[model samples]
Target: MKGRFSHGGGAGALARGRLARYGADMTQSLPAFAQNARFDVCALGNAIVDVLAPCEPAFLEAKGLVPGSMQLVDETQSATLYDAMAAGVEASGGSAGNTVAGVGSFGGRAAYIGKVAKDTLGEVFSHDIRAVGVHFDTPVLEDGAGNGFGTGRCLINVTPDGQRTMCTFLGAANQLTTADVDAGVIGDSAIVYLEGYLFDPAPARAAFEAAAAAAHAAGRKVAITLSDSFVVHRWRAELLAFIESSADIVLANEGELHALFETEDFDHAAAHLGRIVEVAAVTRGAAGSVLFRGGERVEVAAYPVEKVVDTTGAGDQYAAGVLLGLSRGLSLAQAGALGSLAASEVIAHWGPRPMVGLKSLAVQHGLSL
Candidate 1:
């Protein structure tokens, strides 16, 4: 805890000295290490390429996109909209992709499993994922583009308020079959993570089920995140079934958890969910996060951020921090605190990916990532 703030939440003079030594411009500028540190975790989710563009509210209405929500679009619709948009930043994306990426940022060893076409976007996705130090070994589709279906892409529109509206075109991501679930990958890692969004597609569902079975048989753990509210509304019964059957650790934000339990009150939904899953963590933005496990409860305060740019990958990165902490043998409360810390860093920026070096950033805060 050297050079960090005191127990009262105020930084000490030692912290100031360390901050000065690191660099006055930004503590995040510190480089990340621990690429082959032999992590205690790994994950599997949809591998997607993100196409982010600056957008006006009018553009959303003209394109019939619901502002502040994720809408699944068909290949034709995705192409039509994409063709009309301006240039964008193509980054590696997906629910679990963000989580695993955040894990890598914090110097945790992680791997990802998903599908993409053997095209430019796919190459970008693979490169970005690997550059972050997450092992990815899925086979890319070679014949997708000839049939008019391009690679899996997400059209992300960032508004003036820093809110993001997402439109997803599954494409090759939907083609993630059971064969893509490598038993060795499942066995080698300490945990396997799945995204609730992948449950909507039949092929992805089969792949997830196979992966879960492999992880369980190998004596590894299984984790799941309820990706969005609509996904829960559309597949509530199935998600409930998944909680009972496969999920060992479940992560959800306040809104998504309420919708999943069909309740209006957060306390009501959280109480109900706590009884069903082995471990449940619900994130309340600004209000912080809560954990329920073994009839015990823990509440972790939200780490303060100077600014909230884009709320795109806050929850995903939060899960990454929590999982990384757990892999490092930290207590649940410690894990949740790390999750809050990582999430605070992302909200201070514009992209889903973390711009800060999470490793030394944690060390500055007297934390070990």
Candidate 2:
């Protein structure tokens, strides 16, 4: 509310590229503060280790892969791909998991609930997330990787254009159950963020419902992200009912929103979204984002970026910016502004996680970090 514009129906953007670069228009940077809640955002989703390496377009064609998307694969295919590619850099990643990591990068207190196995890659996943300041206490599946199957891994192939084709072996990550949803963590968090991809594993659906109920019972907020367009198509009715009943805030990219509401026209689908949920944020790549709340809707431009190396984690990072901003008591418009900033940073790099402390960057930009 300080410097953020609140005019309804596509008013001028409050934060532009120049202002974002200098943070001159921001009244203050987000501050690291003590809150009554234990965590800023409690993220509940799959836990995964991402293996990233460079490849050519022909590789994708030969392997029958879909560029710029994710899908499940069998253990044999996972092994073949891993063996054929160049050595990759392993990073901990998942849709909502990346968001909590980004929130932590912004110096926000965050917690994670997901499933992983007791194996090499699983340990790597745990250590990486914790190193970034996210609290994770999910119990590990013992002897889970006894054979070739182990922790879930998303094999990411980044072509020259910075697009990542992902093939996932869900493995132990899909084993998450409602019992994995920690009631205390959900109750202690200011908001519980759920990843729609969890629907891939039926038990994760129960986990999501449990987490949402816990957060609601504790009077906290519940947020959901339509993780992928395909995912929305697969569970449209179920997702809509869940959002209408339990979701306080909804996040989706333009394609996903269209798929969810069954219309290609963004505005037509967006109107449907605003009625079902209290608030919704729709991301439009370089076009920026639009936020809808009741009768009011505001547009926020995307932050300027010179390059887009890998879009693997852009949406998750955007959600990170928004959730952290909301938890820090920022206005809706200001929260979207922060989301744009985070998305811009992730697109400029190869990985989903930031290389620098985002909180410090916000301070440098003249925000109250």
The numbered model that scores best in TM-score is 2
lDDT digits (tens) for residues 298-325 of candidate 2:
7888988898888889899999988877
Candidate 1, 125-183: lDDT as tens digits: 89999999989989888887666546788888888777788999988888898999888
**Which candidate number would show the highest lDDT if scored against the true structure?**
2
Worst 10 residues of 2 by lDDT: 1-10
TM-score of each: 0.87, 0.90
RMSD of 2: 5.0
The per-residue C-alpha lDDT of model 2 at residue 162 equals 84
